[model samples]
Target: MTTDTIITARGLTKTFTVRKAVVEAVTDLDLDVQRGELVAFLGPNGAGKSTSLRMLTTLLPPTSGTATVVGHDIARDPAGVRRRIGYIGQGTSAGHNQRVRDELLSQGAFYGMGRRAAATRADELLESLDLAPLATRKVLGLSGGQKRRLDIALGLIHSPELLFLDEPSTGLDPQSRANLWQHILDLRREHGTTIFVTTHFLEEADLFAERVLVMDHGRMIADDTAGNLKTTLAGDVITLGFASEADARAAAARAGGTAAGSSLSLTVDHGELVLPRLLRELDSVTSATLRQPTLDDVFLALTGRSLREDAATSKEEINA
Candidate 1:
């Protein structure tokens, strides 16, 4: 591992046996994350997103393979790894009865910070995360957004070099999600902290992460920038509608597009550049629309299923 590499893993695998059947939760997972990079790890449910995180954070042991986190071997020096990294999981970590500031201080103490330093750090986090107003408030009294912020504060109480967040904004409303993300961005900008996050919100990953890693069926499937992934895998989409199905079919044949009823859809390298040429070449185009491909479209192209649909279905299954 290089000096600037904050995380490195090779052939990491995790397996479980249920009903006398072996199930691989993560397999041959190789990854490297450089310092100060915000990486988004994405996949549908049952895709090993959480499993990979658990292994790297030393919360769960990998069935095979090796990983080094924050310059410490995860399996051989879990305490060293844990001390240098902070993890905020999907669930809340604060105690219901403890005051918010108190919880932060407690976490610092748990990491062996001196009383004065812990108090100072706790106050700093309360101000930075906008939790100062709720410092004396009970954990259960804060709203979902406030509680999530407090969770982040607790994670950062020890000033770790790397932070791992698993679905940090899962249940927030749109406004709250936006607020939380702004704080996260500010942290990365100000602290130069490396962030490895897994989120169900596709737009968040596309908008914020420098690099995106896609996993499915316990394996790494894709790794690239969001724009590159969309461009390379899904491409831009051009839809042209005709008055008659025959006209659409003719246009489809001429442009190598797909026709459904009276509409022809074509995926191209650049829709804006191709649309004008296509219009000049084909006649009887009643309507035309060009759109850039989204991360969901990339997911559809890769897994043969929509990530949004899969996430919804998984949530329903869990609730059932």
Candidate 2:
């Protein structure tokens, strides 16, 4: 492991027995997450994401190998790991009968905080999470957005060193989801708590993570900044269309130096990645379109399939 790594797994393996057959969920996997980094753990459903998280958080034991969370061995120091990490599963936090504020305060007090300190911290977090107006409301009466926010406040009440969020904003409305994302940014900026989260939203993974790790079949396939992933994916394509077939053909030939696609009524002759002097050729052309490279392109290039497809296939394998 590197000097700054806070989460380390070496030769990690996990297996489960179902019926009369043994299945391997994770095999000889090595993972390292740096301190103070918000790492996104993503994959198709049943890609051992929840299982891996459970092992790290001490909810389940690994079949073999070692993992250390926050510098504490998961096997030897389960309590230490628990004390250092706050986990929010893919579920709601509120009890139907409890008040939001009361729930938060109780969470704080459970961690040995005094009543006064717990109450103060709870109120502060309630306001910070935009739950102040709903602080006194019954959990059952709160909106989905409000309840999720309260769940976050509860997760943070103890000032944990790390937070594990599994699809924290899965069912939130767009506005609520945006609010939650901003809050996550603020949490990292203000408290420096290292976070590990999982999500199916590719856009979220693209935008939020400083560095993202993509996984398939419980194995990591790629890890890098989103831009870098896109830049080296494929060759560029330029298309030119015109009003009339002849105009289209002329424009296409002028830009592409050949014919264009069938849908392209105009007549670009050839469609190769590298055409002759593109600028010089297109300088005289007026009607044309260019497809800039993007992360999706990179994802497809790297995975040999679309991200959505990879996710679905992974889900099937996991289920099988």
- Cα lDDT tens digits, model 2, 204-267, are 8777887766665566677776656555554355655444566556555544445544314222
For residue 183, what is the lDDT in candidate 2? 92
Report the lDDT of model 1 for residue 137. 93
| Candidate 1 lDDT over residue span 65-135, tens digit each | 99999999999999999889999998898999999999998999999999999999999999988899999
Worst 10 residues of 1 by lDDT: 311-320
How much lDDT does each candidate structure score? 0.90, 0.74
Candidate 1: give the clashing pairs: none
Which ranges in model 2 have alpha carbons more than 4 Å from their true place?
Answer: 1-3, 234-277, 283-286, 292-295, 309-320
In order, how many clashes per candidate? Answer: 0, 12
Give candidate 1 misplaced runs (Cα > 4 Å): 1-3, 280-283, 315-320
How does each model score on TM-score?
Answer: 0.93, 0.82
Candidate 1 structure lDDT: 0.90
For residue 246, what is the lDDT in candidate 1? 97
